[model samples]
Target: MTKKIVVLGVSGSGKSLIGKNIAEKLGYRFFDGDDFHSTANVEKMSQGIPLTDDDRKDWLAALNKLLIDNPTAVIACSGLKPEYRAMLRQGLDDVAMVYLKGSIDTIWERHQKRDDHYFKGRGMLESQFATLIEPTEEEAFVIDIAQDADAVLNQALSLLSES
Candidate 1:
């Protein structure tokens, strides 16, 4: 069966990059969840304001639609909170979540180097870390982001194989 994968993490955890690579390897379609966000959501995030659950309702619904539309696909999204992850999983039978786990410092360092992005600097990173509810082993195929991209991808692929 074709796998439906969600590459999930905080900003700067390399979800977009990693998800695209995984999709390419697996011959599945790839989507960046940021592209699904409404302009208002982007504006709020661009101003370094953290999104409330209400703000994410439409966005999450849109992502859910994407998941439904493409059964064999890899999507990059910040499924930070448990509720968020649960929402994503709703109505899906064979979805595999790849949580890109990373420390605040590591994420912040990467965020600083990013020249073009909606999510801003340290404050936004801190908010994301605070909001995140780390997924358990049963909930996701967790991969540490301290490793290089290729290593992370290999580990994720290995875990997905077992799952």
Candidate 2:
């Protein structure tokens, strides 16, 4: 059976990058949640400001809808809050979350090295990580990201295939 997998974490957690690989390995399409953000939201992030829950409501609703649309695929997003993950999973019973967890040092280093993006800046990532609530053991797969991409994708694909 096909699976709807969500790669989740704070900014710089490599969710999008690894989600793409995981999707490819699983032969599922990949959707980047950043693309679903509104222009205003993008502008706010470009300014290095965090989005309010109100600012995220519409975007989360859209993502939830898209999860419904693609019953079997992989998507990536900073699902920082438990509520946000729940929102994305709403109305999509087959959807599961995979958290790419890592240390502040690793994430901060990656964020600093990340180039050509509007979400670049220092310190704001602290808030993202602070806001993150890791998924429960049963919510989905949990894997540390120090492993190579191939290994991570192999494990993710295995889990997706089993589900």
Best by TM-score: 1
- Model 1 residue 109 distance off true place after TM-score fit, in angstroms: 0.7
The alpha-carbon RMSD values of the candidates against the true structure, listed in the order shown, are 1.0, 1.4
Give the Å shift of residue 103 in candidate 2.
0.7
lDDT of 1: 0.90
**Global local distance difference test of model 2:** 0.82
lDDT of 2 by residue, 1-163 (tens): 4478889888888889888988776778889989989999999999989888899889989888877887567889887788988899887778878888888888887888877788857657876876778887698688787787777777777776777
Model 1 lDDT tens row, 33-138: 9999999999999999999999998888888778888858898999998899888878988889999999999988888888989898689889988889999988
Where does the lowest 10-residue lDDT sum fall in candidate 2? Answer: 120-129
Off by over 4 Å in 1: none
Model 2 misses residue 50 by how many Å? 0.7
TM-score of 2: 0.93
For candidate 2, the per-residue lDDT at 83 reads 90
